[model samples]
Target: MTNLLLLIPVAIGLGLLGLFAFVWTLRSGQYDDLDGAAERILHEDDEY
Candidate 1:
């Protein structure tokens, strides 16, 4: 039962860390160009 006390905090901390990272990425515009990246991969360049 004592182990549950320790594991609960660790799990909560990890969840919070993941949430913070996701929010940080949102604020930093990390997902702004999602469609552009996909389209870019399909684009072809004409080089001779």
Candidate 2:
């Protein structure tokens, strides 16, 4: 159908966008502190 032609490109574009964002996050250190964040929640600052 004609709708499929339009939707296919949109879906591919979205997939590519998601991939780019994932790569960007890796390069930006977004996931660098995976374990630290979890441990941090269990910690309390002495000042508090």
Candidate 3:
């Protein structure tokens, strides 16, 4: 029971931290181009 007292706050803090990070990414445009990497690799700028 003693361990639970300390663990609950730690768990809540970690969950909040993760939520903040995800929100930050959303605001920073980190998810703007989900398919860009895969689609970009199929195109080439070099001439054969």
For model 3, the superposed segments whose C-alpha errors exceed 4 Å read none
lDDT by residue for model 3 (1-48), tens: 999999999999999999999999999999999999999899996866
Full ranking by lDDT: 3, 2, 1
Determine which window of 10 residues in candidate 3 has minimal summed lDDT. 39-48
**Candidate 1 segments whose C-alpha is farther than 4 A from its true place:** 46-48
Model 2, range 1-48, lDDT digits (tens) per residue? 999999999999999999999999999999988899899889998985
Error of 3 at 18 (Å): 0.3
Best by the lDDT measure: 3
Superposed on all Cα atoms, model 3 deviates from the true structure by an RMSD in Å of 2.0
Candidate lDDT scores, in order, read 0.96, 0.96, 0.97
Runs in model 2 with CA error above 4 Å? Answer: none
User: Candidate 1, after superposition: displacement of residue 41 in Å?
Assistant: 0.7
Residue pairs with colliding backbones in model 1 are none
What clash count does candidate 3 reach? 0
